[model samples]
Target: WQAKKLCPELVLVPPRHDRYAEISRQVNALYMQYTDLVEPASIDESYLDVTGSLPHFGLSAHALGDQVRRRVREEIGITISVGISFCKAFAKMGSDLKKPDATTEITRENYRDILWPLPVGALLYAGKRTCEQLRMQGIHTVGDLARTDRQALAALLGRGGDALWLAANGLEDAPVVPPDEQPAVKSVGNGRTFPRDLVTYDEVRRALITLSDEVATRLREAHMMCRAVQVSIKDPKLKVIVRQMQVGRPTWQRREISDTALKVMAANWREGAPIRALTVTAENLIPADQATEQISLFDAVPQKQREKQEKLERAVLQLRKKYGADSILLGPGDEEH
Candidate 1:
């Protein structure tokens, strides 16, 4: 409503899901021609590992990126931005630096010169809150973050901060997994941008509950249990921060997931901060059949109670699948925020 009010003549077009999926397939096919190590990041973005193919095609990494961009434009009538770098994270970062039929290359020798001066937020996965925390410590630029002690970063933002430090120093080594290989699922999560900013604890709690419920549902559907819960918060200004914590046990219960997400949010988020979006993710996943929960005599929640909740969640899932997603709603007292 705000956008339409600001621009009365603005046009709104509904998404064409089928058309987009078709185009995505064609683009992936084009990438396969260059290398089989094609990792589709999303319907519109992909990462191609052309190391082996570079020698085969007699082209440098940058040349291959340009060729792919040109082929995409000429064949599909769409322009793409390409980033060429030694590692997956840096390549992903480089791709975002340019747009619309451009290629940005970050070689090992030149990466520090090109990326070190940029803001810490420019690094992949460095959310808005993380940037603010880094700035608070007088670490302003990518170089500053890279130069900071890795142990300090880990203490500051957990493992994610450690990842940022690695990426800043160009030490990231994550590979672009091929589609046919079918890598194991590492995490299941959900997030949304609300229509309005959420200011109160109740509002944030409600949003977190919804997202956690969704994540739990997905985990259960896949026969998985997560030992950790991750939350990503995006403020009204479009800055984001991601944090996660161990749930103390591998579980697929919505109540547990929501509680852990709430804890994470409480630790990182300031009271009354206007949140534009919230995400809840289940991480450190293991197969439900394989997950062994150690029964603690000191456990606050009884094992029987936990089992009952799990049964209820499974029943709810069955109802949603048999009827419709909206056919049933969770009772108010199932869990507390």
Candidate 2:
């Protein structure tokens, strides 16, 4: 409504994430041709370490930036802003300082002149809240933060303060990460906002089972298993509560994930409280082949039964894959009696 008032004629387009992902891949492929140390920051942003490529290309940093910018504009029809600096933090700051189709360079000789006078909020990782906190202490610019005592900054914001101080002084040394060296998946989960509130245990249980099934499928697809299960429950009034518990043994099965989530919900929720949304998450993941569980001497039979059930589930999965996702499903009567 406010947008319409601001512009009598305005056009809005829906986002196409898949199309953006394809373009990102094409651009990343181009970056790889220039340097092996290309890091994708987002769908439309990336950081390339051209230190090694400079000697091979025989071009200075600013020249390399211009070359890449020209290629991207000509080949991909996208204009990118480039930032050249000694470190990742300053590079990010430089990138943001310029507009589309421009290059900004921050060097040891000129960084103080170019960056120190900028507002504290201009520094990377310093959000509005952090900027306000710094202003409260009479630190309003990058220079002020650089001059502040390290111990005082540490006392104010812990280790984050140390990082900010390093960035302000152009001492940040973090390296750009490549795609293959990216961190492992830390968790897998699925969530849903129901069309209407669920007010009974059976309703919430059904939703949890559905979400758990999705999470378990993702875990299996990734060849991983979760050692913990977490659930987020939101009331009709929009109040939310999160609860988590260890699963005792690693699992990538919907039965276990759903059961764990149910236990969490039961311990925290009222019997007939209306639920607005639900999320089921599998956490502390590990390779499924590397997961192990200690067996109880007295419960050997149950362990064997579980192994047989797992085999049956795998068979069901194969059958579904051969036919369709909805080809086969477990029913209430399918439970082991």
Candidate 3:
């Protein structure tokens, strides 16, 4: 309401994710023209390692960046900021230094002069809490953080403090992974904010089933199974609580995910408490083919029954693919009831 009052002329627009993905593909194609070593960080950002292509393209790093920027604007009809540096972290920092259509280069010699004067919060992963902690210790600027004793900083902030100290001193060595060389699946999750607050176990149960179903579907699509399930609940006041539990075995079955999530919720959530949002996440993933389930001596659900369930779910997946996504529904209860 305050934003509307302050900017009465402001117009809101809904996001078109499909269209954005299409545009991202087009932009990435342009990046590939210069180097095969393109790493897409997000839908709108990418890092192009043009070191090998420098001789082939007959352009320096800065010059290559300018060319890429120009081609993106000309072909994709969107302006992009470019950053050229010896390392990935500093290059990302340089990109944030300007906006729209611009290029910034951070070299080994000049990084100290350019980056040290900036606020510590300007560094990546330095959030409000970290900033407050740093300020309390008289570490106000990036320089202050860089100059702080690494042992003392670690004592103050744990492992994260050591990482920040390294990043602050330009020792961050994380590589930019190309699209093809990206790491394996870590976790898959789905969440929803309801139109009305859910105040009953039944309501929460239905929501969890819906979220878990989607998460299971995604895991199967990726040919992965999760050994753990995590749930996040947000109340009407927007305070959030998260809980996770290890599964009996790694499984991508919707029933298993939903059941585990409900158990976690029962253990952590207060009964009849109003919740505005809920999320279900499948964690500690392993590839379905590589997953070796160890049968417990007192296991209730036998191996054969679990295999049959997997087959049934795959058949359902095929039916959903043939028809529309909403053609079938699983689970025992309906939200409308």
TM-score of each: 0.64, 0.67, 0.75
What are the runs in model 3 whose C-alpha is more than 4 Å off? Answer: 1-11, 189-214, 217-221, 232-242, 246-250, 253-259, 272-279, 290-337
lDDT of 3 by residue, 86-132 (tens): 88878888999999889999998998999999999988889887999
Weakest 10 consecutive residues of candidate 3 by summed lDDT = 328-337
Query: lDDT scores for all predictions?
Result: 0.86, 0.87, 0.87
Candidate 2 local lDDT, 199-262, one digit each (tens): 9877887788878877987798788999999999988777899999999699997788888998
Candidate 1 minimal-lDDT segment of 10 residues: 328-337
- Candidate number with the higher TM-score (2 or 3): 3
Please, what are the lDDT tens digits per residue for candidate 1 over residues 1-337?
Answer: 7889999999998566547767999999999998899999889989888888889999878887888888999999999999888998788879888876789998889989998998888987887878989999999999999999999999999999999989899898888888667678899989898989999888888788888888888888788999999999989888889999998789999999998998998899888889998889999999999998678877747787888887888788887677555566554554522
